[model samples]
Target: MQRVLSCFFALFLGLVPLASADVEVKAPDVLVRDVTNEVLEIVRKDRAIQAGDTQRVFGLVQDKVLPHFNFRRMTMLAVGRDWRNATPEQQGRLVDAFQTLLVRTYSNALTQYRDQVIEFRPVRQTAADTTVQVRTEVRQSGAQPIGIDYTLEKTEKGWKVFDVVVAGVSLVTNYRGSFGDEIRAGGIDGLIRSLEEKNRSLETPQGAK
Candidate 1:
């Protein structure tokens, strides 16, 4: 699961600025397919990212990939019922910390890119539906195909991804157990502090390690 999750970040590579404007009107599946192609092309051509430029990778993710995600909702879901126990300020901190943790932890995936085939399944959704799942599969030679599914909601801004399930494991759910442990040990503030520490520890590039 961890290996698949690590490979998942590679999909975020090479996001171009031009795609931002069209996101609001594009269907969920179309958006995923287009962005995946754009990102893959950029990753293939950028030598810096291929050489493990952590700063550049992190910047691209913050600028391009993050806009497509609803981090606050992701954090809330990951934290489960404990989310309501947090104050507004603490909730904001949790969102920031979780976002940072993800970016820092997976930023190095830019350097690990292999030419894996990505297959997008036909989307099942209607115009009246506000939430939909965009399913995809990653195929690599000698390995079983891994399923990656994006759960998105139609917000005023566009379709924002609130959760990702990789190989049947929900990303938020994967963290929920550890988050619950932290909250039980020290409260919401403790979870924020723990995430901050994890982010800091991951500041160095994975390649460097």
Candidate 2:
């Protein structure tokens, strides 16, 4: 679990400006390679990030990484079948909580960056396709390579990632079970509270460690 989380942050090593207003079929592939290269440089050179500066890392993630993601879709997917039952306000809260949880989680893992290299695999998609998967591998020293895949969809603005797959484990899939349990145990509000509590812990001095 720790290793997978560590490699997951490997994908955020780059922070380039967004792709064109309308991303092409090959845009996701290019986005992965280009952003990873940029993020590598950021991680490699940023002293604050390397030193585990939570605010700095969080800021970078919010400004650079979050923009490329479709957090609403991600939140809905993780919430599973209960999504339709969630009210508009509840859904909004869920998105915020889920997004915050991911940002903090990835930010912490990002401090473990160590000049890892990413190699993107060929994208298999037709030109007319609206959704596609961008595959890649993370190469690290003294460790086995890990598979990282991004699932992106073409929106009116551009290509945005909805989910990330580490090895064969889907980010949404992994969260769905736990989130479902929370919803069943305490309802949507309960799940929201749980996520909010988790995010609050990450904000504390001890949780930052």
Candidate 3:
């Protein structure tokens, strides 16, 4: 699971931009392919990101990739039944914490890129379809290729990614169990604190750690 998550991050390095003028009109598959190539090139040349400058990576992610994700939907899915129980304010906090966790995870993953090749598979969709899965494989030297799939839905703004499946394990599902456990232990606030703490730990300087 850990290996899949790590490799998924390296592949994820490419799917960051929705700010492009034509992205709104592009098909989901094209969007993924084009953005993947575009961002991979950026990562390859950015010395700061290559040198492990997490702040730069974080900013890049915040500015580029985050806009394309449906994070509220992601938090709701991960929280499951507990989502309805959370007050609006609690739900808002949960979304913020969850987004922070992913942003930090992505920052760490961005630094681990090693020229892994991404192969995007054909996406099957119809004009009536509202949701579609974009399948891709990450190929690295001396290792088997890993499958990474993105679940996206067409929205008013554009196509937004709601979940990612790594090696057939859904990212939201992976977190759901742990999130459920935390909610059971201390309620929603407990889960929030737990996520916040995790984010803080990730934020700590390496020298301090």
Candidate 4:
């Protein structure tokens, strides 16, 4: 669970943007760094968020974080080949449930932020490149720095993140096994129910779960 949380948090932390990365190829890398920096400051200053206010944290994530992500793509990648097996309705539900699960799971983890510094590794991609990897490192107090990388694709609106890698673990790959198991046990609907139940548990008070 700790590992999963760390990976999820790393996804957001790695998604921030940097103001200095003005070039097109480096845009996503810069964008994620800047956004992460902005979010860290918000977490550092907002008392309500620090106190585990789910609404406040969710609002921040929905407004500031979701816009930069390609949730459908992430969901599909996480589902792997099984994505094609699901009906359109199931795919939609899976996307929604998965997104909610991530939002609920990682929003509270934001409060753990405490002066963690992010360092962006240099990116080398041409303007014509449609996909790229933006790499970074998170330096935390009393802990070894962890590597966080984003896999983003260029779109009409901007560069949007579809996958994340934390400490060499691929976010989509991390869930592949569990997702497969759920689908095997109860089909696509089962996976959706599992995710929905998990989200509900997160919404519940600690005493309930």
**Candidate 4 per-residue C-alpha lDDT over 1-209 given as tens digits, one digit per residue, 9 for 90 to 100:** 46645545744744544432332445666676766677677677877766666677666677767767899999999999999999999999999999988877777676555677888899988878999898988887888888888898888767888888888888888888899999999989999999999998878353221
- Among the numbered candidates, top lDDT falls to 3
RMSD of each: 2.3, 2.6, 2.0, 3.6
- lDDT per model vs. reference: 0.82, 0.81, 0.87, 0.77
Q: Where in model 4 is the C-alpha error above 4 Å? A: 7-26, 204-209
Query: Model 4, residue 129: displacement in angstroms?
Result: 1.1
lDDT of 1: 0.82
The sequence of per-residue lDDT tens digits that candidate 2 reaches over residues 1-209 is 65796678656545344454424433678767776786687678887777777777787788777877899999999999999999999999999999999888878787777777788899998889989998998887898899988898888777888988998899999999999999999999999999999998878353245
**Number of clashes recorded per candidate:** 0, 4, 0, 13
Ranking by lDDT: 3, 1, 2, 4
The local distance difference test score of model 3 is 0.87
Among the numbered candidates, top TM-score falls to: 3
| Count: clashes, candidate 1 | 0
Error of 3 at 160 (Å): 0.3
- After superposition, the stretches of candidate 2 with alpha carbons farther than 4 Å from their true spots are 13-26, 204-209
Q: What does the lDDT come to for candidate 4?
A: 0.77
All candidates: TM-score: 0.93, 0.91, 0.95, 0.88
Q: Mind giving the per-residue lDDT tens digits that candidate 1 earns over 1-209?
A: 66877866766442233566787767888878887887787677888877787887788788877887899999999999999989999999999999998887668766778688888999999889999998988888998988888899999988888888888999999999999999999999899999998888778653443
